[model samples]
Target: MKKKPKLLKKNEGLNPAAAAPKIEPIVVPINKALAIRVVLMAGLVVLKT
Candidate 1:
């Protein structure tokens, strides 16, 4: 049996990319305190994943 092809609405085809969150570049801090926090958070994320 053959199934019919789906027809997308005006924005349906492009909606997924548009709906996704945009990623911003991460800026590293020169300050020691802020840098440590960022490193810890990144390490935790890596371990979790």
Candidate 2:
């Protein structure tokens, strides 16, 4: 038999550091690279629909 994972209640802090929400930083490429990627993705979506 497998043990169930422990569930933590909202606003319930067992450990201050652990209880805090961890945020990951977004990675953005240079403007020129980003523009090309966006244009390619848009073209793909248009073709798919």
lDDT of each: 0.56, 0.60
Candidate 1: C-alpha lDDT: 0.56
Regions of candidate 2 where Cα sits further than 4 Å from its true position: 1-29
Pull out the clashing pairs in model 2.
none
TM-score of 1: 0.37
lDDT for each residue of candidate 2 in 1-49, tens digit (9 for 90 to 100) = 2333343543335665655443212223456678999999999999999
For candidate 1, the clash count comes to 0
RMSD of each: 11.8, 8.3
Question: How far in Å is the alpha carbon of 41 misplaced in model 2?
Answer: 0.3
Error of 1 at 10 (Å): 56
